[model samples]
Target chain A: MNHKELIADIAGKIDLTKTEVEHLLDIIVDVCCEQLEGRGSIGMQSFGVFDVKKREERLTVHPTTQKRMMIPPKLTVNFKQSSILKDKLKNVPS
Target chain B: MNHKELIADIAGKIDLTKTEVEHLLDIIVDVCCEQLEGRGSIGMQSFGVFDVKKREERLTVHPTTQKRMMIPPKLTVNFKQSSILKDKLKNVPS
Candidate 1:
């Protein structure tokens, strides 16, 4: 489902107004982004752990030209599913 | 960070009471689990998508005895981070 649909579902399930749910969702997204941008990680149980990983600069060969190229250091976000969530999903029917 | 610490952080950031944050977190976890168990996915923008994936049963060799064994079908939860979040993380300093 998309964002609107997901928010609707959350509101229905929680008996909250759509506006309130949307506001809260926005806050959650903002908080997560801010945390990762500052500390490189946000740990939440049952949901998952979001972390930033860095790849150092490296020399790589160009496949076609056979020339060496320097790849710049980069950062990436990684998500590790929580074991509790994993176990729950494992039993879910397809 | 652990669950409690994470909740505390969320509460502090949002200016919500710890108890309220904990309660909402619990509800979120319950809703996600219930949705996955009924269907197979929960899609949330800005956060990520949580979906159940099935691994079909297969025959595998036992390394020690070299005997064929049947591997049962398995389900797993997969998370695909959103591009927006990925970009934010990529710019984060390590």
Candidate 2:
């Protein structure tokens, strides 16, 4: 669902107004971005863990040129879903 | 960080009490789990999209036995990060 619909769902579940839920969701996104940019992690129970991982510099071939190029080290965010959530998804009917 | 600390972070940014934030978080987790179990998707802007994918049933050899076995169809959840969030992560200092 889109942001507005999702916020409405959250508002219904949490007994909060749509505006309040949207504000909270925005805060969540903002904080998560800030934390990951700072190389930190955020764990939400029954959801997943969001963390940053740093990859080492390496050499890789340029796909089009087929020539070796230096790939610089960089950080990336990874998500590991909770086992409970994973199981629930696995059993979902198609 | 763990669940409690993450909730605190969210509460700090949203100006909500810890209890209220915790309740809201719980609702989010519950709804997400329910949605995925129903083979639905939830997209949280700046965070990521959570959705279920169904894999076709197939025949595969057992890892140790090397005997052919039929693998049943199953569902899985996938997350795709937003490009803006991905770039923020890629530029994080190591």
Please report the candidate that would top lDDT against the real structure.
Answer: 2
Residue lDDT tens for model 2, A1-94:
7677788888887667998888888887898888888888888888888888777899999999999999888776777788878777665556
Residue B50 error, candidate 2, Å:
2.0
Best by the DockQ measure: 2
**What is candidate 2's lDDT per residue for B1-94, written digit by digit as tens?**
7899888888877667999889888897887788778777888887778777777899999989999999888777777777888787766668
Please report the TM-score between candidate 1 and the true structure: 0.74
What is the fnat of model 2 with respect to the true interface contacts?
A: 0.75
For model 2, name the residue pairs that clash.
none
Candidate 1 reaches a DockQ of: 0.48
* TM-score of each candidate structure, all chains considered together: 0.74, 0.80
The residue-level lDDT of candidate 1 at B5 comes to: 69
Residue B54 of model 2 has an lDDT of: 72
